[model samples]
Target: MSNEPVSVGDKAPDFSLQASRGRTVSSAELSGRPYLLYFYPKADTPGCTTQACGIQEALPALGRLNLTVIGVSPDPVSKIDKFADKYGLEFPLASDPEHELADRYGTWVEKSMYGRTYFGMERSSFLIGADGHIKAIWRKVKPADHVALVEKAAAEL
Candidate 1:
């Protein structure tokens, strides 16, 4: 890994991953619109639920900004499928089981829990411009207020 923070104005890496609904989503395909690319650790967890639901509820407002919201995680397609159905998540959830996209965005890093250090996906989000450049990046995000914060960022863009 390069240990580089994918900063504002850097070209966002393009990737394709299986969606929770059995389709493939790619950065190249989401042309001519800004997007909020968020990385979460797991599917169906309490914190993750709060974050996803918040975004779901704010979809309309976010749409007015011409932004697409996408959630990425290291969970398998099957798990993500269930989580999406259970929560009625309207936004697409992409699977990155091998952490390729997460690593590329620098969201995968060493994390600590209960005094134990381990590697995991550090919750993060990026505001990617229509031209494929990153407009903003949020690292180690707090799940509860994530949606509101993302909305704020999008409004500024």
Candidate 2:
């Protein structure tokens, strides 16, 4: 993948991934409408949990704005299922264990923590418009600030 992340106005990459509750989500099916693809580092961890739960709480508002939300992670489907079940998250949590989607989106990135460096998913979100072009992009996002930012962007979209 290029060092540059997918930017606003770029066409979103296609994906078909397994999700919680034995569901499948694909870019094809989500076409002709706006959607939010939020990538997190892992499932069920502190920040991830906070972000997921916050988004879960705001689902009604987001749906009212006609924005579909999908949380993507490098976790397996089984782990995603568990995370969703544990938190009662109604939205799809897609598994990206192979990072195909992340690579295309540029969220799978090099990171560092605790004096160590590694590659991982950056906390990011992309708002894709009905025409399939990206409308907004948020990278290295804070979990607490995600929903409000997305809400504002989706409303404007």
Candidate 3:
């Protein structure tokens, strides 16, 4: 895979991730429908929780627009399950424990914190059009701004 991040208008990378509620979410299954795929560093953290709850709160509005939302994290299935259950998140919370999906989506990235370097999932999101092409990309997203931004993009789609 190229090191470059996925750009808008490119066909989104296909993914088949295990999600909460014993579900499997795949790009093939989502074909011909608009959706939001968001990546967060971890589950149940403050920022992640804020972003997730915001998405959950906006689900009704998003549904009215025929948009589905999926939250992706490096956490395992058990952790993702707990987080979704605890927050009462109705949308799919996908586990990317191996980060294969992250890498494919270009959300897996390098970082430095307090003089140390490591790799982690960047807070990012992709708004995919019904035709399976990416309509928008958000890198290093802020939890506070995620919902409104995605909602607008989905609306445009």
Candidate 4:
């Protein structure tokens, strides 16, 4: 990986992963279009569900801005399928079980909880512009406020 960390002005890293419901997406295909790439820790968890549903609720408005949203997590395809079905999420939920994409975006980091330290995806969001450059970045995002922020950013895109 390059030494650069993803930031507002840097080019977004490339990725190709399997999305839920047998759909797949690649950064190559998303090129020339603005999109939101969100990295979460796991599937079917409280925070993850809230974030996904929040995005779900904002889909219509985001569409008006011509922005696409794809969620990434270190979960398997089956788990992502269950998550999407349970929550009725219409957006693509990409599987990143190996943390390949997370590493590229620098979202994977050391986390500590209750004195237990571990490495995991650090709930982050990236807004990639139509020119393939990152327009904005939100690291360690709060789920409750994520969607509205995304909506606002998209509208201005």
Clashing pairs in 3: none
TM-score of 2: 0.97
Highest-lDDT candidate: 2
| Candidate 2 lDDT over residue span 32-84, tens digit each | 99999999999999999999999999999999999999999999999999999
Q: Which candidate model has the greater lDDT, 2 or 3?
A: 2
List lDDT for all candidates, in order.
0.90, 0.94, 0.93, 0.91
lDDT for 130 (candidate 1): 87
After superposition, the stretches of candidate 3 with alpha carbons farther than 4 Å from their true spots are: none
- Per residue, candidate 4 scores C-alpha lDDT tens digits across 1-157 of 4324677888888889999999999999998999999999999999999999999999998999999999999999999999999999999999998888898899888899999999889999999999999988998999999998888887888
The whole-model C-alpha lDDT of candidate 3 against the native structure comes to 0.93
TM of each candidate vs. truth: 0.96, 0.97, 0.98, 0.96
lDDT of 3 by residue, 1-157 (tens): 5457889999999999999989999999999999999999999999999999999999999999999999999999899999999999999999998888888888889999999999999999999999999999999999999999998888887
| Candidate 4 lDDT (Cα, 0 to 1) | 0.91
Going through the candidates in the order shown, the clash numbers are 0, 0, 0, 0
Question: Which model, 1 or 4, shows the larger lDDT?
Answer: 4
